[model samples]
Target: MFKVPPRPSTSRIPYAPLPNQGNDSGATPKASSPARSHRSSSGSCFETPVAAPSSSRRLSYAVNSGIKPSRPSSVSKGRSSIVAPAYSNLSSAKKPGEDPRPLKDKAYQADCIQNIYAFLESRGFDKPFDAGMLQLPSSKLFLKIFEFVMKQIDPRFKYGNKPEDDILDFVKGLHYPYNLSRSSLQQAGTPHTWPPLLAMLNWLVQTINFSDATSGPGTTAAQPAHLTPRRFEAGPLTNLTSETSPLDEEGCRAVFFEFMKESYNVFMNTEDETISDAKSQEMMQLFTTYFEEARQEVALDVENLKTELSRKEATLERMQDKSELKKLQEDKEILEKLLSDLIKETQRGEKDLQGYEEVLLDKQQELKKCAEITAGIQEDNALLCKRIQEQRFSKDDIEHMEEKLARRKAVLQMLKENRMHAGKEASKVEIQKVKIMEEIGQAAKKFNQRAAR
Candidate 1:
């Protein structure tokens, strides 16, 4: 009959790892997170916020001038909806009783202006005014003023034809003479401050013109009513607040221009102060963040250290267990070897016992045969004695009687020899049986010893 081979047992198959499988102890790592994926993706790149330098300056001027910049008609709705936090809110809130010192001081203002003049002079600008060069027409102050304005507009601007004529022509375009008061210029006493004052006026004109050009037409309509520049001419210095006396013939305009320059300097100085304040605040916040991060990092380090200690403890325990298991395995192997030796000795003892039993059986058979022979010899001796007692008195009978007596005596002698040989054989068999029994007791003692072990 054709028989199919039996299939191999499933228990014999080696184990294999499955795909995307978790461990039996539930220690598998989790999948990647969405946030991590997004950060790692090739398409993600950060953009720096565009901070317009001109915009902040313009915004400051607009706040003071009542003239606001026009918003774009096509501005994003999302952008328009997002309201920036007020500048006041950007600083930390102050206590009600904390009185702040004034942002500007007259002494500080004068000192700052002096510093500016000193810095300019130090850079080799003409200080002929201080050198007693008081005659305005005799100096190159006008040309210097014109060149300064041109450089402020464009560093590469050159005087193509008559430099003076070109400068005058540019001034005419800005309605210069129209804005200046004739009497004020003639009354400016010492012509020393003329060139700088004119330069200041021209700089202001340029600033206003640039603002107008950038802000577009609708900017004028967006002007706020309350915020207006404080005028120092016939408006405030003389008419409104006559608390101080005039310094010169063009006292109003001179004070006004001086105020403009002072205000501009104050603004610039305050800006630097504001930057310093911001930097200090940033450093404070950075220190705060650094401490917080340091604390968290220290905590993490402590936790990691604890985990490492625990892991090392577990590893130590595992090593100890391995050592114990190895000792147990060695002991088990030694016991197995001892058991195998005992079993072999038992087999050998059983074989020796079988051989002794066979010898005892042979000895018992010999003893039985000797017993039968002795019984037969005793019966024949009794029969022979009875025949001798009944013997006749004839001569032939006497001769037969002598031969019978000799035969009886020989039979007795042979019987005695057989009896003695049987006794010796029985004694030898008893000794061998005792020896065999002693050997069996020894074998049993050995077997018991093996069992106890």
Candidate 2:
């Protein structure tokens, strides 16, 4: 439902001669009557006012009076108070208003047209389009173009009885980014209302192009190359490879669906069995062509993948060998450094061991001397015991013997302290010697393991 402004009155309106609409003499037509002239002057008060062409009588009156009917100017200084009629049937007679919408840039329109045609051509659309088609497309041509575009988007999308409503619904469903009015789509045949439709189609074209580019083969979301449906494949037709051009999987599917639909319709509609048989043969031939093309494309892809895999495997083998060799060289250098450090440590240990050995020998000699002193003390005690047993004693002799015994005991205590100190020194020396031996043994074991490696 469209809301249109009221039509302006034509009474007392001026009739200005349009450019190149004058007589052969190049003279402007003058009003024959004073009333006509007065009316023309009175209409000049309004700025760029458009009057409805009421009937043929008004046009005849202007022609007989030698005054031309006014023609609307293509350009206007401001918003002209003229509006197109609501009904498309009266579109030719109606004057278009000064559109609030800005004109599309010519460069931008040309680019969009070019892109749309390029996309259509890529999709194998047979019909050609010029710039004029978008500028002032007929309803029939517009619908045809729309159907083609929608079919490209979805091969099985069928147009219903109200194609205009269907198209509007489909565009609305897509959430088209621009303003699209139902009125504009309803009167799509008119030049004044066709721009939005053209823009919508261009947008659809761009969307399809973007989707194809992003989701084509080799992308993560692309369909598997090898998944060709057997139902869509060629039947028993021969000479498959010679007849068809290469087709992608999607193309093959679309072609097969169309072929089947057409075949089914022909079979159901035709009363003649011979015609049905011929149509079936043609469908078979068409199917074989698409099937072969798709098959060839899949084969080529498989071969390319195989070659790529082999190349990668060869590269991996080379890299693995080089990496392993480099690792071995690094490990060998590490082992050599460890062996050199161990050798240095072994030499240091030997020096420390020699020093420890010398200390041990000194301790042993001290221990032996302490043992001899201990033995001498024991023998002296024995001799004193024997003397005590053999001789009677006076109190002065006994006191004298007690003093000697106390002095000997003091010597023996000094000897025992010396011996204990020597034993502690010996134990410390033994511990050091054992630690040195263990370290030497461990270093030797590591050196032997490295040699084996």
Best model per TM-score: 2
What TM-score against the true fold does each predicted structure earn? 0.18, 0.27
RMSD of each: 54.0, 39.1
Report the lDDT of model 1 for residue 354.
Answer: 100
Candidate 1, 154-192: lDDT as tens digits: 345455444444443333222231223333343332344
Worst 10 residues of 2 by lDDT: 82-91
* Residue range 1-453, candidate 2, lDDT tens digits: 101111113332123221223333322322221111011232221111122333333222211122112332221113221111111111112232333322355544555566566666666777767655666778887888888887655455555666666675555334343456668877886767765566567667655544343232212222233322223334322222223344745545534444433443453245566766665656656665655666888899999999999999998888689777899799999999999999999999999999999999999999999999999999999999999899877899999999999999999999999999999999999999999999999999999999999
Output the TM-score of candidate 2.
0.27
Which candidate should be chosen as best, given lDDT against the real structure?
2
Measured with C-alpha atoms, the lDDT of residue 112 in candidate 1 is: 28
lDDT score, candidate 2: 0.52
Which residue pairs clash in candidate 1?
A: none
